[model samples]
Target: MAQVLFLGGLGRSGTTLVERLLGELPGICALGEVVHLWQRDLRDDERCGCGSRFSGCTFWQRVGERAFGGWANVDVDRVHTLRDGVERTRHIPRLASAAQPAAQVREYASYYSRVYAAAAEVSGAKLVVDSSKHSALAHVLRAAGDIDLRVVHVVRDARGVAYSWTKRVARPETDGADEMTRYSPGRSALLWNAHNAAFGLLARRGVPVRRIRYEEFLADPRAAIIRLADFAGLAPRPEDLEFLRPGYADLRVGHSAAGNPMRFTVGRLPLRHDDAWMRALPPAQRRLVGAMCGPMLRAYGYPLNPQEAR
Candidate 1:
């Protein structure tokens, strides 16, 4: 069975940073946001940060070879032009089930085990990182009874997440621009709340899970990295931190450049843009997010405004 590390969290919550860092670990290959199962159209014009066009990404091309047995000669331009709608609903489920069997959950585990093995072979990494960050996918992976799965539940402040969403919303048009614009602060908060809640529920049910705050991870990354290594049963190494640094340069779909300052290859790192949310977010938007996600803020150990709490 292959060792699988899942960096599960809501979008824009620093999953990419964590994924890159983990991928840096010797023998670890991290693939960014291969949420192909949820994709309605196989094509999207956006590059997946692997430096390859999504439909033509070499990493995914290899994954496709193992998954489907032969290249199949997928059309990248058509895939990019494809619209993800009704057709996706049918294909997504089939692809997901193909990766895991309903009758034999262990078969699903074996499927992922193979996937990880394939990834390791391609990237020459001992471990594989999946940054899908989807609760549903995580649930399915957990159901597979083969590999030892570790869930890294990464969280960020709701306000910060919302602010980040606002920035993305203001970006120039590209493939799936419509889908991207829909991720407002309200939506972002709901996603954060739901994802964290789902992860919490799974943890309570005895899934091998660990939670890490984006704030804490930024504040003392070495300590946080050590803790994560310990939880994953990985021996600490000097190269681990070095591997994690390059990921900060990855600016792709579902990945953010905002958190780059929090990243360091070694030694003590100072906080960067931790309070940027306060200054970046307008007073109205901040108030709205605070009011909307007050309960969640409290649950995540954030203080709600006194006036709003009442």
Candidate 2:
């Protein structure tokens, strides 16, 4: 059976870096945000982590051929639509419910299992890191009986997450198309709660889950990697972390489908906390983020106020 490290949490919570770190480990293959593989990578023609177009990459081509015979028969638009409609936050309750109809759910999950099985076979690695960052999708993938899935729920301070989303970071994958995302602090806070809460429910429902705080991991990545490795049933040598540098690891290119432009980071990974929000974010937004996410923040051991967060 193929094992999967399914990354479930809000984006910008350090999942990409974590995924890259895990991918660099021996016997682990990081298939970047496989959720975005169909639409962003295949249909939108985004760049893979190795800097090749999706269809142009030999590794992905092989995976496709092995998983689904060929890419021509896979309808990107249709698959993307089906995935989004069935696995967004709004659809979580139904998908997780035992009483709900699941004909389509089974179909989508079957697609994921085949892809994951093919990835494991092609990479010759026992572990696959999928940083899709959606709890609902994580639920679907875990429901697939054939794949042994472990969830890594990454969390950051809600205010930091909200601040990160407010910035206009360019999507390097899209070239000159001006791809970027911005969300209001209120929206980010609410979604953060919803996503994390859903992941918690999944854990309570008996899925193997290990929650990693971004700040904690940044403080001691080696220990963090070891703990995560143990959770995922892998053994790491001292040299498995040899890629670690002062700030960032010397990460290699992966066949990631979609994620932050950091997916393309080749050399040094600066292990710096993004606290610029403390100085840059307005008071109202900070308060809004805290207020919207206060209960969950307290539950997750974060200070109620951003000013109090270290």
Candidate 3:
């Protein structure tokens, strides 16, 4: 069985950075957004974090060989079908319960178990980090019965999330030719609510979940990361975290599966809490996001009013 530190949250909520930070730890291998692995890497042949095409990346090629004797042995379409049938947002309820779906769901979960275990085996890391950011996928993976899955639920203020969605950020993994997807303020808020709510239900189901607000994590990166490392079952010495020096972190290029373009960044990167949304987001739109997020905004420790948040 593989122990996976699963980062579950909505996009742009800072899971990618956390994944990167965890990857730098001595015995952890970060595999970004494994939820998108089938389509993004195997089907599309996108670039891996190592800056090589998926087919050309030696790391994933070995992972494929180790996991299923080879990627060729797996039925991509059947795996997709099984995943689609049992990993939808609607299936979270049943997937998290004792009466979790059998049959295809179990079969689907077996694939993830193999994938994670192979990642650990190939990298020779004590644990693997996956920033999949989907609660439904977390539930599906938990059904495997052979994985030690730990969840880190990242939350950001909905207003910031709405502002981020409105931005036209480029998708560098797609050769900077395509931009990332965008969503309306209402839709972003609703997703923020729905995603965070699922994690709440996930925690009650006895999963080892550590909820970290994006704002708080940035405010104290050093302490925050150490706490997160501990929760994920790693006991790091002070020297193990020398990557965090003052306000910047020393990063390295990784062979991630799929994620934000930031995953490719290396060397030193500045860290800060992105509060631009407070001023840049239109007042009306900010209020709309707040209203849409409703109680979840407060439930996650976000102040309802814009002023109080600051």
Compare the candidates by lDDT and give the number of the best one: 3
> Which portions of model 2 miss their true places by more than 4 Å?
99-101
Better of 2 and 3 by lDDT: 3
TM-score of 3: 0.98
Lowest lDDT 10-residue stretch of candidate 2: 95-104
| lDDT (tens digit, per residue) of candidate 3 on 156-182 | 888999999999999877878899999
Greater-lDDT candidate between 1 and 2: 2
Please give, for residues 1-310, the per-residue lDDT of candidate 1 as tens digits.
5677888777778876676555545556665554442132143334444333445566756765765463354443333333132112233344343544454334433445566666666666656677767765666566556567888999887888888777644322233354344467777777777677777766755668888888778766656777887787777777555533421322223221111222222332223435677777777877878888888778777766533321
Ranking by lDDT: 3, 2, 1
* Candidate 3 residue spans exceeding 4 A from truth: 98-100
Per-model CA lDDT versus the true structure: 0.59, 0.85, 0.89
Best-fitting candidate, scored by TM-score? 3
Steric overlap count per candidate: 7, 2, 0
Could you give the candidate ranking by TM-score, starting with the highest? 3, 2, 1
TM-score of 1: 0.71
Summed over model 3, clashes come to 0
